[model samples]
Target: MAIAQSLTTTASLHYTPFIRELFDTLLTDSWCEVSSNRAIEFVEGEADVAVEKLVPYETRSEQGIFFTADDITMKIVNSLAAEVAVEKSFFDPSCGAGNLLLGIAKSYPIKKNLNRTIEYWSKKFGGCDLHDNFVIAAKLRLIALAAIRHGLPSISEGQLASFVRKFDKFYTGDYLEADVGGDFDCVVANPPFGHVVASRSNEWSSGRTQLAAIFVDKIISSGKKGQKLVAVLPDVLRSGSRYERWREKLAKETSCGAVELHGRFSKSVDVDVFILNLNNKPSVVGQIIEWVPPVTDTEGSVRLGDLFLVRVGPVVPHRLEEGDEDFPFLCAKNAPAFGVTFPEERIKFGGTKFLPPFVVVRRTSNPCDKNRLITTLVKGIEPVAVENHLVVMKPFKGGVNSCLKLIKALKDPKVTSRLNNVIRCRHLTTKSISSMVLQGV
Candidate 1:
């Protein structure tokens, strides 16, 4: 059910082996119904595998997991494609059954006849996917859409045969290595997300990298001036400290626009996603990027980073030994919310240790929960070894009194709402916590 559930509205037609078989029969029957030579030839030629293989690689591999939901796909397409003129073009490097590309095509008005329309639109719209079955599905859906849009119950067999040839740009291939020519007006994609093993030589990130992040860099590098890239990327690329350098590099390449948070990709997939809009070229000189979208209600508020020395707890329980039996050890389990906690155990660690009069927030959180930040005050007399799962917020200028005030501010409902917008992922990032804006502090 987990694999089947990953299928979005776009991929709903062919999820299981039985469904794929039906889809295959339907496409073959449609070609026969049209009595078209080229369309039939195209379908038969690309039949490398059986219908069972078309159930999407997402079910089998981490590399090809998570497709964009229908609402999200249409939103990106309509927002970006609406501004594009009829003469302008759109392309998706990793189209994945043409979810985004189909939305783009649907946004445009249908021209003269179905054949002429497909001919003209095919040149304006282009995409490629590594899966051959996905490419076939995309072409089939486009042809079906053309027929429906043209106001016919169905175009006669021969009348729509030319469509199969018109979609020459849609093919089965890897976009990362392919030569993506032409200056497209907009390039939209929901690239795959997961840790990639191979080393990367890109300027944004090197060594082990995320596949989605690498796809973004490749797409940007392939883009021409005046081009726009609208991508649904993992939230970590925006808020994780590991990508801070990548963010810095991205700022120099493209002008960052909107950062819309869409919590948790799917019920099955644990990753959170955000829609990032960027123009390929740097419109402004020396642009300093604001990774998280700024909240508008901060009139008299200041960033938590300015008021506190925010850091993740330095203790890794398995790695450290009991050096001082008398020292206290504090972890999330024993750190009660809104209550004072004293470390009871000790660890032999040479890393940063926190003293009392500091606030501790649980690093793991859920946006769907009633409270996003679970806070506790540590007011012991001795230094404590805090577990890595808790984020320690030590006031820079304010001592014990400041810690109490900070706790009060964090308890506000507005703080929870704001933090939800800042980082939707389950694990709260240190950078995101630091970026938290506190009111009346």
Candidate 2:
């Protein structure tokens, strides 16, 4: 508690002595069940601390507890609340400081016409976290939000107690360890990402499991029939060798859709993220949605179906040596940048044959970046077999030119600027090549 108090105090620069003293009192209090009067006192004290510390920081700065970009959160909230008929009860399993929840709540329409809907939805919204500090922060955020919506900073003792009781919605246990009791109408979470090591008796070790894959599985398992979920997943889940079976299992178990976001949310780890949406209803075979930059004034967003092919890189056994000419490979380590360039010495001396002309995208990496696409327009090659750690995509038969167009189009400053460290490639498809040739005409 001293550590918490010190951190909070240092983080808050504009607290009055009264507010500071109140916080110091609450920080030392060990009551598991705080009285309503104490809760109100605590909230008022914390609000002063938060207000001082809540000054906006640059989008890329790490000052905020939530790492995701604000724009990303806005887009997510907009998408989730787009349809009014959908029972929109928001739930975040890893509700860190309630940022996502707060963002959603703040975005809800406050006008008289929409007040009823907002109130109805707020009552149904729920969230939970494994950290006690986060629960406290989330409750403070809710109190602050209530103050903003209404004109008072004070809640009655009973109301304050009720708020703390609901704040119990935020738990203090491992998400995977708990039963999660009832399924949510909609679940949104950003679970931890990385490799998951499970013993023989653990559920995820039937084969290799990416942390994101396991978390995705957990989200789906936590949902009841008709429940939908949106969770942030590492790019590795989309393109990792360890996720092949997991992907198949997920696809088979539920209908899934995703939106890919480049760059790390907050941490230095440059992981690619996707907003995955799943439901227990019959599979809806969702079309891939790519967020291309705006086009002409009249045409802003474009949604093309089946325009790109997605395939995984070849998997060579670990026992195989590098000199194998029969199956030349491209491991994650060898993935090239935007332009198809690799160390020639490694190519020649490493004894790996050059893959044929095809676009090779890295399947997995420690820090997922945007330049995952690799274009190989080096002429006179046909479908090349990609090695483990890379996924190759070629445009359909007539897409050679389109593929080329995509390559060139991707070279635009706008596209390339975003592509840095996120995408890479070494091959091209006939359709891609064809597309490149006919782009502006």
Candidate 3:
């Protein structure tokens, strides 16, 4: 209980301690069942110690428990709620501190009867979290929201226990295995991004992926036709080459809705995130939605994938030992940007080598960069080993002149805009590069 107390004490700073004293008073009044059911207890001794003096105990980043800022939470909820009818029946599988649930509750028009409103919405919204404290906090926040709207001075012990009992649908459990029933119309979540070992017997799961993917996949499988889903997910799920199959499968099962990019999760978290909307009604089955492909008005435009044998450089510098320097080795550091150059360095490796008269694009990219594709024409007569951090695009039509034309084509402003739209993560993907059209070439 000490660990739980400290975790709550810390979480309160981020979520605000508006209800901390109320909760402490309520729990001290012997409302222990609400806080201890199926709970994971913490070390007993630390509850008496000051929380600030101790190193912050964070749930592993893989748990994806980064609490959404109030502004961002409201934005996510508002964006999703705008698309569909104002429905009260909603659920958050990984409900952390009830940020998302409170956003939904606020969407309803103010009702005059506070008790009825609190009682009704409590059952209308369904949610589950692995942590008992989060579930308790979510219920309390919902009740407090009602109290604030109606201007109640205080809730008595009996009234507090009554409201807590009404939130029967919100419980503690693993979302992937829990059965939330078919009562909810909208399923909303910010599921964990960490990889989990999915149940091998489940047909919907394909072994390893971010937990967010698994959560969405399970919802799609169990959801009724026309059921709504709104989730905040990592940008990598949108653009990474590794998730292409995931996108394809999702497209096959659900209708394409919308993808709204929100730059960076927050000031503290480095990952970029986006809001995704979907439904069980499949309209564009098996057809991936082009979330943001560069629009074109010109004729005879073709994808670069159609022209070049584009692939990531095969050499992983750190994994291999420095053996005989048999081939010229090129990497992001040695490869000059926007210029043609040859490297004298060589490395020992038995892998695919790119010949001279090809283009090497640095894979390290940021959305804020002036040019998303940092290009260089590697000119030489002999084939050389390129580091995996660079993507190699060998022309199929001609030689060095084709490489030059490709490099020049990449310099176009439209290409930069298009690349930024295709992928915003720190690293570029071969899939995104290959998908870029040879515009203005």
RMSD of each: 6.8, 10.0, 6.9
lDDT of each candidate versus the true structure: 0.71, 0.49, 0.71
* Runs of candidate 3 exceeding 4 Å displacement: 1-19, 22-60, 70-72, 80-86, 202-207, 281-288, 297-302, 318-325
Kindly indicate the candidate among 2 and 3 with the higher TM-score.
Answer: 3
Which consecutive 10 residues in model 3 have the weakest lDDT in total?
38-47
After superposition, which runs of candidate 2 have C-alpha atoms over 4 Å from their true positions? 1-66, 82-87, 107-123, 156-159, 198-208, 256-269, 281-441
Per-candidate clashes come to 1, 45, 0
What are the per-residue Cα lDDT tens digits for candidate 2 across 131-244?
A: 554555665556545544553334444444445455445565666777662356677676665455654764445544555566567777667766777676665555434445
| Model 1 ranges with Cα > 4 A deviation | 1-61, 84-87, 153-162, 198-200, 282-290, 296-300, 321-326, 397-399
* lDDT by residue for model 1 (44-74), tens: 3222232325545555355564556666776
Error of 3 at 44 (Å): 31
Report the number of backbone clashes for model 2: 45
